[model samples]
Target chain A: MPVYSEKVMEHFQNPRNVGEIENADGIGELGNPTCGDIMKIYIKVKDDKIDDIKFKTFGCGAAIATSSMVTELVKGKTLKEAERVSNEVVAEALDGLPPVKMHCSNLAADALHLAVEDYKARKAGKGPIGRVETPEHDENEHDLLEHA
Target chain B: MKIINFDHFAATKMRPEVREAMEPFFMQEYGNPQSIHTLADEPREALNKARLQAAELLNAAANEVIFTGSGSESNNLAIKGTAFARMDKGKHIIVSKIEHFSVLNAVKALAKLGFEVSEIPVDKYGSVDPMDVKNALRKDTILVSITHASNEIGTIQDIKEISKIVHENSGAYMHTDANTSCGFISTDVKELGIDMLSAAPHRFYGPKGTGLFYLKKGIRIMPLIDGGIQEFGRRAGTENVPAVAGAGVACELAKKELKDRTAHLLPIQKDIVSGVLGSLDEVYLNGHPEKRLPNNLNFVVKYIEGESMLMWLNNNGIMVASGSACTSKILKSSHVLSAIGVDPALAQGSLLISLGEDNSLEDAAYFVKELPGVVNKLREMSPLYEEVKKKNKV
Candidate 1:
C-alpha cells in the first residue's frame, strides 16, 4: 500500500461533487480505457465565468477525490482563472497524493483546463474547443467538432 | 494520521523460533562457505545441510537444488540456460500467457536470440489447459515452462498433467516457477514430473535475497554468470549464508505447519471472496474459484482503479498488492489480467489479498467489512461510475 495523505483519504472516503451537470455549458473528457483512468468534467459558464462545476471520474479514490476537489476549486471562477488551476493545487487541496497516483490529480487539472478552454474557444467564435482525442479516436474529426 | 501504527500485513512479526535459528549464521559463523579454512568448513557444511532441508521440502535430491539471489534470477537461469544448452536440439519454447514477467520476459529474450516462442492462452479463470501445451508443441520445441501458481490470480496449474504431455511429445524439459506456491503447498518434483523448478523464500516467511532452482541431474543448462565455482558452478556468486539458513528454517517450519496453515487459510480465503462478492455488485473473481491457492483472494471492482484502491487501503492501515509487486512500479494494466480477457475498466480495479500464515481470521474479517465501504465511497465520487450507473439504469 502506498502512503496517501489524511486529507486525500478523507476526500476519497467522503468525496464531494460526484455527479455530472445536466445541460452543461462545456463537457471535458480525458483519459481512455487503456490508461485505466477516465474523467469527465461538466461546467456551466455564465458571463464568461464558471457558474457551476461538477465531475464524474472513473478511477481510483485519489482520482475521484481529486476530481471532486477540482470541481470545488473551479466553481464560480472565471474561465481564465479556472484554466490556471494547477495539478499541484488539486493535490494540495487533498493534502497530497501518493507519488504514483499524482497523475490522477493531474488528470483533474487537465479536465478543468479542457473545459475552460472549450468555453473560451466558444466565446471566440472558434466554436467549442474540440473533444480531447483519446488513444482510440481521430484528432481531425474531434477538432472539427470542437470548432463546429 | 493515527497515533498507533497498525500494519495488517506485518501483524505477526518474525517468530522467535525462526529468528533464533537464523542468529548464529550472522553473529558467529560469518565465514564464506567456499573458503578452505575450518571456519569455512562449518559454514559450508551448514550450507549443504540447508540445501538438503530445502530439497527435502520439495521432495528432490539435495544435489538438484542450486541457490540463487532471487526467484527472478532463478527463473532467468532456468529459461535462458536451458535454451542455450539445448539449442542444438531445438530452438522453440512454449509458455502460458499468464506466466510471471520473469518467465514471459525470459522467453521474449530467447525470441530475440532467434528462438520461436509460443504463448499458450489460459481460460477466464487463468488456468492453462495441458492440451493447449500439447497442441503448441513442435518437433523443434526444447522446453515448456509454466507456473505452478499464478502470482496475480493464484490459479494453480496442473503441472503433472502438463508435464506428462510435454514428456510424451519430443521429450521437452518441463519447468515451473513455484515461487508463489512451493512453501505453503505440498510440492513433489517426481509426482509433478517437473525437471526444473524455482522457489523464493521471502514469500514463505523466510528472509529475502534467498531463492532456489531445482534442476534435475543430466538436464544440462548453461550458466548465466561466470566466476569462481559456486552453486556447483551452475550459478556463480558467494552464497548469502544467513539468508539461506533462514530460508531453510522457514522451509522446515512450513513443512511442520503446512496442513494447519492451509486449513486455517482456507476459510479466510473463502470468507474474503464471499464477503466481497456479496457486498459488491459486478465484482468478479479473477482466478479459478476452487483451484486457487488457499491463501489468495483476488477480485476486480469495476469502477475504481487498482492503484487508488491500494492507496485508500494503505491509508486505512491495510497492506495488500494491486498486481505483481514487480510490475506495481508501472501504471499499465497487469498482463495477466489482459491475457485472461478482463475488461480494461475492471482490470484497473484489480486487488489481491495474499494471506500469509500469520494473517488471522480477524484480519480477513476486518478487510471484508472495510473494503465495500471504500469501494462505494470511491464509486460515489467517480464520474465513470456515475456514467456507468446511469447507463445501467437506462
Candidate 2:
C-alpha cells in the first residue's frame, strides 16, 4: 500500500476525544470480529444537539484514525446533522485512507450511527442497546485478510 | 528514535559479509551459470559452494539442495511438485493449521486440481499434535508439510516426532518450512527424519529472491517452472548467481554463529516477554512457553486491536507485526489464532515481536516500558472495557 496521507497518519498517531462520557445519553459499540477491530462510541445530547462525543477503537491505525475523525466531525452538530456523516466524509477528513483501509471508515461510521440509534431507542423507552453485528462484508475485506 | 527491528519473520537485512561475497558475481563474474563460457566458471563454483554450505547446515548431501526464487516458491515446489510427481501413487496431502500462506495456498490450489487435503489443528500454544497428524493421514496421503516454527506465534513444532508419525502411518513425504527456525533452532534433515524442507535465505541475513528446497535423493518432484536445466531441471531459469553466493555465505555464518546469536538474542526475548506480560493486564502469550523460538514473542491483549499498538510502536520507531484483520490480506482474522480456539475479537489483539542480532537489552527494556502505557491508554477509552470493569465489580 502507498504511504498513508499526513492527515490519516496524524489522526492515527494522536487521536482526538479518546474516552467515554460518564452518565452518557447513549452508548454504541461495534465490532468486526473477522478483522478483530471493535469500536465503542459515547455521546451526550442536549437541545437536540450532540453536545459532546468520544470514542474508543480497538483495531488498525485506520480504524483509530477514523474514529477520531468521526468524533471531531460529529461533535457540537445536531443529532440529525451528525446522522448525515458518512464513511466517505470520514475518509475524506483523513485526506484518504489506503483503499484497503476504507472499510475501517465504514466501521467508524457504523459505530457513530449505532450510538445515535441507541440514543433514539432510549428516548422511545427501549430497555438497553444490545451488541450489533453486520454480517455482510465488502469484497475488500477479503483482500486485507489475504494480504495482511 | 532508534528503530528496533522485530519483524525479522517478515524480512531481514543482508549481512555485509554476504554482500561482499556476492559483489564479484554481479560484475566480473556476471555470466549465467548455465552458460558454457569461462565467465560461468566463477558463478558455477559459487553456486556449487552455496549448495554445499546449505547441505552442511541441514546435514544433507550437496545433491539435495536446489536453489529457488523465494521460500514461498520453494514451498510451492515442495508440496505441489511432490504431489504432482507422486499423483499416480496418492493424491492426499496434510498440512497443519498454522502453515504459512505459501504452504496453505499451494495445498488449496492442489485441492482445486482434485487433490484432497486434511488440515490438522493446533493447540492454544499453536503446537500441532503428532497424534492428530497420525489421525489425519490415510493410505492415499502422499505428503505432510508442517512448518518447523510458526512465523506469527513463534511456536516450533516437534517435526521429528510428527515426521515419525507421518512416515509410520503412510508412505508420505514430510516437508517443513523451516525458514523461521533455520538459524535459531536445529533444522537438520537427518535428525528430523524428513524427506523435504524449504528455507529462505533472506530470513537469515541473506539476499531476497534466494532460497533452497531440500529434496531427499530419489524423491522425484515435477517442476513448478519449466525451462533449461537449472535447479537440476526442477526449476528452469538462469540461477541468481549473486543471491546464491550471498545466501551461501549467510548460511555458513549462521551455522558457525548460531549458538552465540542465540545467546545474544535470548535475553532480550526473555526480558521483553516477561516485561510485557508482567506489566500488562488480561494479556497472554500466544505460543508454547518453552518450545517457542528464542527470539520470538507473541501475545493477545484483551479488548483491543493490534494495529493501534503497532502504530504506537512504529511512532516509537519499533517495527513489529500484528494479527489484526485490517493488517492482513483480506481483512480476515488470523487463522493461526483461531486454530488455537481464540475468540476472533481477541485475535485482533495479536502482536508478534521477534528479536534480531541488532537488538540490545536497552532496546528490549525500552519496548517493555512503553508497551504497558499504550495498552492501558487504549483500554481506558474502550467502552467495552468499562462494561467489563463494571461487570467485574458486580
Candidate 3:
C-alpha cells in the first residue's frame, strides 16, 4: 500500500468544508485537459472578506484533502490574503505530500488562486478572465487541428 | 465501529489452511526436483503433481503448461517467441490498445524488428471490437494477442470471438494474457479457442514469482531463454518449485471457492459503484457495467487527480490502486484510460479498486461513505470548480 501521512488521511476521511456555496461570490474552474486533475473552487465573499469557502474535487485523495484544507485555511480571509495562500503553505498544512503527489497540492493552490482572482476581477468590473489557452505543440496534426 | 485498514491489497493475510499446506515444502521435502536420489523423489513427485493440478485448472495436458519466473516473462515468451518463430510466415501482429504493457511493449520490440503491428481500439468501456481485429488483419498477420480481461478498467474481452476471427481470417495464432482473469473466471483454453494463454499465480492468490504459459499441441514457438532442459526445453533455468506448488494449491482453492467468492465480491463491487457514483455528480464509470471482473471497480472522478485521491485513501487506511498500479509512478495518465477516450481531466482522477477474496462489504461501505466528502474538500480549493460553477450560473 502507498504510504500516506496520518494527518493527510485524517483530513481525507473527515474533510472539513465540503459542498458549494449556493450564491458564491466567485467560482474558479481550473483543469488542464492534458493533465487530468480538475478542481472547482467556490467562495462566498462578504464585505471584501471570504465569508465561506467550499469545493468539489474529483481526483485523488491528496487532491481532495489538500482542497479541503485550503478552504479551512482561507475561510474568513480577505481576497488578497487568500491569493497569498501558496501551494507550499497547503503542502505544509498537510504535513507533506509525496513527490509524485505534489502536483495535487499545486492544483489545489492554483484553483484557489484562480477563484480569488475571478472574484477580484468581477469586483473591479473587469468581469472574469476568458479561458486560458494551453501551450501548443505543432508536431501532432490532430491536436493542432482539434482546437482550430 | 471497527477501525478500517487498507494494507490488505499490498499483502494478503495468509489463511491457516494455505500455511499448513506449505509447511512441508520448506524443510522436510526440500530436495531438488531434478535430482534422482531418494530424497529428491518426494519433491519430484510433488512437482509433477503440482504441474498436473495446474494443467487440470486450465483444462490442458500437463506437458502443455510451462512454468515461468513471472507473468511478464510468460507474456514476453508468448509474443516474442511466436513472432520470431513464425517470421518466415508473417510479420504482422494485432493487439488491443488497452492491453497491459507486457503485451504492448513486446509488440513494440517486435515492431523494432520490422514486424508490423496493428493496435485495435476499444469502446468507452474498454471492450475491443472483434470486427476491428478482423478488419485490421492482413495475409501476413501471424498473431492476434488480446488480454482476457483488462487490468485497469476491469472489462472482460470476448477472447473466444477474437480467437475465431483470427483463425478464420489469417489462420494466425491467437493468444491471451489471462493474468487478471484466470481464477476469478472460468478458463478453458480449447473452449475459448485460444492457442496460447498466460497466467500469474499471484493474481489468483498464488505465489508472486510463479507463472504459467500454455501453448497448444503442434504449435511451435522459439524459447526466449537458453540454458538447461527445464520446462521441456521450452523455458530454461531451475524451476521455482515452492512457488509453483503454492500456485497449484492456490488454483485448487480458487476452483473450490469460485462460486462463494464470486457471489461475495458482487455486493461489495455493487456497493462501491453505486455509493461513490450515486453520491457524486458527473462521475463516470470507466469500464463495462456488467462485463467487468467480479472483484474490480474502476471510476473516473472528474476534475481531480487519481494520485491525490489514492494518497488520501491511503491516509484513511483504505488501500486501493489508481490507474495501472505498474504505471502509478509515471505522471502521465493511464494509456488504458487514454485508449478509451476518457477526457484528460476525468482520466487523471481514475481509481481502480480490485477486491481480493478477503475484502468485505463493510470495507466497500466505508470507502463509499467517505469518498464524497473527500471529493468536496478537494473542490473547495479548486479554481476549476469555481469557474465551472460561474459558467453554469448556479
Query: Mind giving the per-residue lDDT tens digits that candidate 1 earns over A1-148?
Result: 5356777767766667767778787878887755666778888988988898887776666666788788888888888888888989899888877665664235889888888776666667775664464453222232324322
What TM-score is obtained for chain B in each of the predicted models? 0.94, 0.98, 0.95
Q: Pick the candidate with the highest DockQ.
A: 2
TM-score of 1: 0.89
Backbone Cα, N, C clashes tallied per candidate: 4, 18, 36
The segments of candidate 2 whose C-alpha lies over 4 angstroms from its true place after superposition are A136-148
Pick by lDDT: 2 or 3, better one? 2
Model 2 DockQ class: medium
Worst 10 residues of 1 chain B by lDDT: B2-11
B98-169, model 2: which lDDT tens digit per residue? 889899999999999999999998988898889998988888999999999998888989999999988887
Q: DockQ, per-model, please? A: 0.34, 0.64, 0.28
Evaluated on chain B only, candidate 2 has a TM-score of: 0.98
- Model 3: per-residue Cα lDDT over B16-134, one tens digit each: 55556567778898887788788788777767877887788899999999999888898999999999899999999999999988999899988998999999999988999999999
Q: How does each model score on lDDT? A: 0.79, 0.86, 0.77
Tell me what TM-score chain A of model 1 achieves.
0.79
How far off is residue B373 in model 2, in Å? 1.3
Off by over 4 Å in 3: A1-33, A37-148, B1-15, B324-327
How closely does chain A match the true chain A in each prediction, as TM-score?
Answer: 0.79, 0.87, 0.80
Candidate 1 stretches greater than 4 Å from native: A1-16, A65-69, A86-105, A120-133, A136-148, B1-14, B324-327
At residue B72, candidate 2 shows an lDDT of 92
